[model samples]
Target chain A: MTNIKKLISKPLFLPIFCMILVMAVNIIFDAINGNFALNFFTISVRNGILYGRLIDVLNRGSEIAILAIGMTLVVSCSAGTDISVGSVMSLAASFCCMLLAGFGVSSTSSYNVPLFVGVIAGILLAGVCGAFNGALVAFLNVQPMVATLILFSAARAIGLLLCNNLIVYVRVDSFGVFGGHLGILPTPIIIAAVCILVATVLLKKTALGLYVQSVGINRKASRIAGVRSERIIFICYIICGLCAGIAGIIASSRITSADSNNIGLNFELDAILAVALGGNSLGGGKFRLAGSIIGAYTIQAITTTLYALGVSTEQAPVYKAIIVIIIVAIQAPPVKAFFARRQAKKAALKGGVA
Target chain B: MKSLKKINGNTLLLLITIALFVVMYIAGCVVYSTKGFTHLQTFLNILINNAGLLCVTCGMTCVMLTGGIDISVGSLIAMDCMFIAVGIEKWNMNPILLMVLVLVIGAVFGMVQGFCVGYLKIQPFIVTMAGMFFGRGMTAVICTEQVSVSSSELFVKIAQTKIELPFGAYTNNKGVLQVPYVRIPVVIALVVLIIVFLMLKYTKFGRSLYAVGGSEQSAVMMGLDVAKTKLKAYVLSSVLCSIGGICFCLNTMSGSVQQATGLEMDAISSAVIGGTLLTGGVGNVIGSFFGVLINGTISTLVKTNGKLLSSWSNIAVAALLCFFIILQSVFAKIKEKSK
Candidate 1:
């Protein structure tokens, strides 16, 4: 009983409970409203909702989930948050598109070289951008936000300039096939799964993950203990960049074109929101990859649900803002502590009365 | 020598800005004289048109000096434009009343953000970012669409009236190079700059802002009301942003959500280029004014050249931002080494 109580008392346990409760409430509300129908027999089918929409959500969520994993690491370092992840993603895509175009791979081409080269170039360029961010924050000791903001503006401009402010559509069969689903599973899902497995192994089964947590918990103490804090921070940024690059490739492929202006716009905010919603501290320390992935799904689900309910596009930002507020408020330390203390007080009062 | 060193960081940035201006001016003169472009007038117009950005940047510097940031300023500007458009075009209200209303709204928005950040202990970035979303969202809800002041007599007067100097030539082809009436908004902006500069340099609140930003823990131990100071700084920033927005509307005679889409970045870049440390506590309102001018001139140069894409303006601004940040980082290192 004590062990169960302790488990229930864990910080993340409450949020997970809240998430489940919310999902359940939403499901019940939808059912009562007659928007959903479930059959308990051998085969179940939905009449109103489309399977394509679900696939779309999964494809979109997968890329963001992959990037969020890397963002979690970067945020776990004492270094500041990167708002330039979207810009980095765009830069990667633009570079990839440019490289493909330069290689005489027309939009009508059936060649696979463009697809292979684009992915590699995109990831490499993203790594370089990440390395630049790391150098500014770690070596130069610049604030993370400032260092990243500079690149945020510069990198996006560079991307747009390279692409000449136009959408670049690559017509490679392999590229389209790469984004295609294997039976019922999407390519992005496969990529996300591989990323998550690798990330989990690195963070949970290695000393590097422990060092990252230690550095986040106490930079001075970690440094004193002979941890290469700067190097770790650099690596985290590189990972973030690489993840963003991969996400960009997937996103661009899904659209079948690289949009210089709108590609990966405000993705960093989504990634940060996902990480924060997962109950991770912005001040650094503990990280939960599973929680982060759930948070991404939760956000995507909320948007999808809202859209399905016929919410106007113009009002979407307001709803998104409200949801973000609720999520942050729930995660706020004082709010959480207040609830915990109130529960404790209630128990104590009952005991006293008894 | 000590004082010089102390101000050397600011001085170096100022010198670089002046050099850039000189280079741009020389380039502009050479290009215009050679091309004899009719669009040279448009270049001047662009510079005059962007004076609102200068005002916003000036306010941004003040808030940033207090170790706080206000992304909501962009939204505040949007709100200001909406209110001004409604006041003049819909309600047939006085321009002064519109200005006052915009300023009040800005103050309230800033206060709310400040309350969350200062009193509630929410992170400044998160609070301001939320405020940004809230402000912009509310503006869209209220306006529902773009609002234009094309029919407003006062707005037209403010926009069209321009003062001409004796030193410049007048031509009918350009509708007179000089006018008797200077832009009232520009004059207001100038007055605001002077007042803010005085307050920052000579007031107790200003000193406290610097002290708090220098080190919050130390300021608290010193018995300064750090929260109040920070709150006031944000309020001041919002008010300035509103006024800047009004100025922007007066210049363009229109209000739209897209009007100041990327103005926040411009303001931030200007503040940084003007030698305001991103880490906070050190900045000058005057420097930010020059930073805006530099930005305005870059776009002007591009427009006057006619051969270059306007997108190059963003590239130039980004380059300038990087240069200033790198210089500041180096200066900070030097200061640290000296210490």
Candidate 2:
């Protein structure tokens, strides 16, 4: 009972709660509108609205979820946030498109040798961009915001320049299959799950993860304890870059075209929002992969619910912004402390009665 | 001499930026002369046209110095443009009244952000980010589409009137000239710079901004009203942003929500290129002016080339932003080593 209570009070619990709450509210709304039915221990809903949309949520959630996992590591290293992940993703996508196109494969090729090659090349390019960002923040001692902001603008421009500001389409069956699903499980969702699993194990079972948490808690103390803070930051960025590259592939594959300008636009914002909403402190310490996954799903579910309720696409950002504000407000220390104190008083009264 | 030495590093950075500007301009001149499309009048016009960005960048530098940022400035400019268009075109208000309205609106927007950030202890980035969304959304809500001002006699006169000065002439058609009235905003920006420079150097509040930015805990311990100081800084930045916005609207005689979409980035890049540290506590308004000039010159150079995409401006600005940030990092390291 104590272990269960402790688990419920954990920071990771909030994102899951948020997701479940949103899902419940959505189902209640659906039921009122006669879209859901419950018949003797069985439940049914409109297939398009619930199950089909869940697939969409999973597909879209994958990129941000993966990026947030890597971002968790970067933030845990006390290197601050990277706002250039979106730009890096775009650069990778553009590079892949350019490579595939250079190989003379039309937009409708069934088998293309260059497709896998392009993915590898794109990942490498993204890694290099990440290294550049990490170098500035770790070695040059520039603020993470400014260093990444430079790369954010420059990388996107470089991508657009490389692609001549054109959207390039590539048709590769293997690439499409990577983004497609098997038995109602989207490939991106599977990829995200695998990435989360890896992150969870690495963070929970590895010395490097502990070192990163120490650095985040107190850089001076961590350094005194012989942790290589700079190297940790560098490695974290490399991982972030790799995740961003994978996200680019999924995003581009979904559209069947790589748009230099629009591909991965505002992705960094989404990833950061996911990380923040997942109860990962912007001030950084312990990492939370499950929380981030739940957070991403929550965001997607909210949008899906709003859209189903006939909300305009333009209005979605406004609602999402409000939700973000509320989540952050609740997560604020003062608010949490108020609730904690209330719970403590209630527990004391119950003990006295007993 | 001690102050000079302290200011010397920033000055050297400014000089290097100016040198780069000159080199780029010379290269543009060569390209234009070779293409037989160089025009002295056109070059002067470009400088005058870019004065509004110069004003906006000036405000950005001040805000950045205080360890804060305002991405909402671009959207504020959009709002200003809408209001100005509505005031002049719809209500037929006096042009000066429009300007005053813009300033007041900008100040209010800034104050709200300042209150959230300074008093509520909210993060500057999150507050400003919220402000950006709200301001842009408000602009769109106010004006469904572009609003063009047609019959503002005062604004049109200000924009159309040109005071030509004799200079270098490549041809009779391109007689050497300068437009004084068109560059009025630049002059206004210069006056603001002078006043701000004095305040930064002499006033307690100005000193407190540096202290707070350098170390908020230390500033609080030193009995400085860090909250008030920060609030005042942000409010001041917003007012300057408003002025720049109005000037921009006045220059174009039109207002659109999409106008100044990336203007915040332009202002930030200019501030960074001018030697403002991203971590705050150190910057110069004058250097920021040259930073804007460099950006302006790049666009002009691209325009002169005729073959290159105008987006080369963004590329050039990005390059400069990266270069100067690297430079700032090196300087910071030197300072740290000295300490």
* Whole-model lDDT values for every prediction: 0.75, 0.76
Q: Judged by lDDT against the true structure, how good is candidate 1?
A: 0.75
Error of 2 at B248 (Å): 2.7
Instruction: Locate the minimum summed-lDDT window of 10 residues in model 2 chain B.
Output: B173-182
CA deviation > 4 Å runs, candidate 1? A1-8, A14-18, A37-56, A103-113, A329-354, B1-7, B35-47, B86-98, B143-145, B170-182
In model 2, the runs with Cα more than 4 Å from the true position are A1-9, A28-34, A37-51, A103-113, A172-174, A329-354, B1-8, B34-43, B82-102, B138-171, B174-188, B253-257
lDDT of 2: 0.76
lDDT of 1 at B235: 87
Most accurate candidate by DockQ: 1
Clashing residue pairs found in predicted model 2: none
Tens-digit lDDT track for model 2 on B1-339?
887777656667777877887787677777677653355655556657766777787777777877887777887888899888988877989988889988999899899778766775656765665566566656766665788988877888876666556555344436743332335665566677787778778988778878887888898999999888889888988998998887788677888867887788888998887777778887777778777877887777777667776657778888888889888778777877888
Best lDDT among the predictions, by candidate number: 2
Q: Write the per-residue lDDT of candidate 1 for residues B1-339, one digit (tens) a residue.
A: 876767577677877776776677667767676554333344455446766786788788888887777766777787788778877888888887788888888888888777766765666776676666666666766666788887667668777777653443545455755432346676778888898899889999888888888889999999999888888888888888888988888887766665576677788988888778887888888778778877887877787677776678887997888778888888998888999
**Tens-digit per-residue lDDT, A229-310, candidate 2:** 7888888888888888888877777776678788887677677778777888766787776777788777777767777787
